[model samples]
Target: MSATAAISVRGLEKSYKGSRQARSPVLKGVDFEVARGSIFALLGSNGAGKTTAVRILSTLLKPDAGTALVEGASVVEEAQRVREAISLTGQFAAVDEILTGRENLVLVAKLRHLPSPGDIADGLLERFDLVEAGGRKVATYSGGMRRRLDIAMSLIGSPSVIFLDEPTTGLDPEARLEVWKVVKELTEQGTTVLLTTQYLEEAEQLADRIAILHGGTIIANGTLAELKALLPPAKVEYVEKQPSLEEIFLSLTGSTKQGDHS
Candidate 1:
């Protein structure tokens, strides 16, 4: 493992046993390194083994072959230590629906045995922009607010790395942007984030490094500019620009809102 790497993997392979003679291979000889305090995105379509890779790295599953290390600790041999150093948020929001946002955070903080759990919860609620909704039940919060609270709960332990698996899957465009801002804030605070998403724009917007996983392997890995360079140069064409559907919707809505306010 490199000294500068927060996470490292080499020759990682995993397969699931199916019927007597059948086996389903997910990850095949996967290798990658994540630099400390940077966002690394694993971009892939459904069934591309992105979630499998995350599960293995987060110590929820063991690799059939090869090695993975989290902050110099072996994920296989030192899973407990690895778990202590990382937090994972899955595809769906994990906050308790019956609990208020503040209660949800306080629950996690207490579980982590942090001193002054209430103070930690209050701080995170403020940091995640949930202060206004802190006393509202999670069921009453918007999808974006619940997602933000989920991430804030994960931070109670102050882990060095966080794994987000398709976090914005069901969110609207505005909600997606809200999650993006949270991700940016995390990286700015020196947290290493590994997020898996099928959205090309999501990776382009947030990832410092991107790995494109295809057919159970990494087909390309580099900065966005470097990956773009691998493609043929674009041929310039002269054409009239037209507004997209999203732009049209926003424009129409803006006009309606202004008229109502007037």
Candidate 2:
């Protein structure tokens, strides 16, 4: 593991066992390194093994082979240590439904055994713009509000690394931007983040570097410009109109949308 690498994985492999002719791999000889205090994005389609890799790094699941190091500590040998140093926010909001926004934050703080749970909760609430909704039950909050609270709870422990698994999946355009702003704040504060998203725009907007997984392996890995350079420059079509085609289609067909507009 490099001294500056927050995470280092070499020859990582995982497989599920079932009846007959087993040894089907989810990750095949995976190798990568994430620099300290950087935002790294992992991109892949569904069942591409991105989530499995995150689970291993977060110490929720163990790899069948190879080694993983988080902050230079062996993930397999020091699984507990890795868990202590990292936090994960998955596809859905992880906030407690019954608890108020403030209570949820405080609960996480207490779980992490922070020195000052109340202060941490208050600070996070204010930082995330949840103070106005602090007293409201999470179940009653808007989608965006609940998502904000979930992210706020994730930060209460002050873990050096965070894994966000499609944090903006169900958010509206404005809500997605709000989540992006929070992610930017985390990086600015020198926190290392590993984010997994299927959204290409999200990776382009936020990742310092990106790794694209296809068929359970890293098919491509580099910065946004570098990745784009690998492919022909796209020809963007710009149209000036009061209402866009997508908007018209959605209005006409009533299709739901995801992600930011700009």
Candidate 3:
């Protein structure tokens, strides 16, 4: 692990077993570093080992080959300490369906040994705008609401590093934007966040640096600007000599997407 990085991986590898057949390797000697307090996006197609990498970093799974470190602690040798520094929200919201929103938050806070579970639970509920529905069971919550609660629960211990694996997967456009705002706020507060997503736009919206993974390896890793520079600067064409469809799209969408060619 580098002194400056919040999370680091070097030659990491993971494989799954199946009978006596050769184990299928998911991550093949991957290497990357997430700078402290930055949103680093891990972009990949489905089954490209994005979740596997996240699992290793979050200490939910160990790498079969090489090393992974979180906040300068070895994930294999110092897993407990590494786990102390990180929180993870996986593909599914981990909230209990039987528990009310407030109950779920309080449960997590209590599990974290927070001194004031009530205060912490209330604070997160309000911050996530779940105050009105706080008393409702998670089963009654919408997908977006459940996702918010899941993320809110992860913050109970205020872990310095957060690993989000496709955090906004099932969210609608508006809900996705709301989640993006929350992720941005996390980075602004000096929380290091490593996000894994298949959506290029999501990475462009939240990531300070993007790593594009393919076939179990990172094919490209750089800032949006740096990666954009590697390609030809775009040219525009208007329909009525006024503005083209791309122009209208750009006007509404913003220049960020042009750089999101990941």
Candidate 4:
């Protein structure tokens, strides 16, 4: 593992017992490294073992074979230490519907045994741009706001690494963009993020490095430009440009819809 890598996996493997006498392999010798204070995206389709890998790295599941280290601590041997260093926000929002945004954060802080939970919750509310909505019940919050509060709860422990499993799933375009901004700010402030996303554009927009997983293994790993370079060169041709429907509509209406108009 690289000394500077915040999260490191080597020869990782996992298998689950099936109905028959055979076992189904989920992660087959998966390997990757995430640098400190940078975004690393695991790009794959459903059943590509993206979530399984996240579960292992976050100490929710044990790998049948291989080693994973978070901030130089072994996930298997130092599970508690690893837990202390990481937070995970799953595909769905985990906020309490009956609790206000501020209350939810404070509750997490209290669970983590942090001092000054109220102050911590207040700071997170402002950090996630939910100050005005902090006092409102989570049930009344928008999808974007709920997602923001969910992430805010994860930060209550001051984790060094965060696992975002398909973080933008089920979010509107505007809401997805909002979450993207929050992720960008986290890396800027020296927090390492490991994101699993099926959205190629999301990886292109956010990942400092990307690993494409297939059949439980990393088939390709590199920056966006590097990955593009691996593909055969495209043929160049000159043709008359045509305006897209979005451009045509914008030109006609002079404005765009606020959310998913489709």
Q: Name the top lDDT candidate.
A: 4
Error of 4 at 92 (Å): 0.5
Tell me the TM-score of each prediction against the true structure: 0.90, 0.86, 0.87, 0.90
Q: After superposition on all CA atoms, what RMSD does each candidate show versus the true structure?
A: 8.6, 6.6, 5.8, 7.6
Candidate 2 per-residue lDDT, tens place, 20-90, comes to 86877899988889998899998776677888999999988989999999988888899889888988999
Clashes of each: 0, 0, 1, 0
Model 1: ten consecutive residues of lowest lDDT: 253-262
List candidate 1 stretches off by more than 4 Å: 238-262
Candidates sorted by lDDT, best first: 4, 1, 3, 2
Which residue runs of candidate 4 sit more than 4 Å off their true CA positions? 239-262
Instruction: For candidate 1, write residues 183-219 as lDDT tens digits.
Output: 9999999999999987777888899998877667787
Tens digits of lDDT, candidate 4, 184-216: 999999999999987767888899998887778
Candidate with better lDDT, 2 vs 3? 3
Candidate 1 global TM-score: 0.90
**What is candidate 2's CA lDDT for residue 70?**
94
lDDT of 3 by residue, 82-130 (tens): 9899899988899899989999999988887879999999999999999
Reference-based lDDT, each prediction = 0.86, 0.82, 0.84, 0.87
Error of 1 at 206 (Å): 0.6
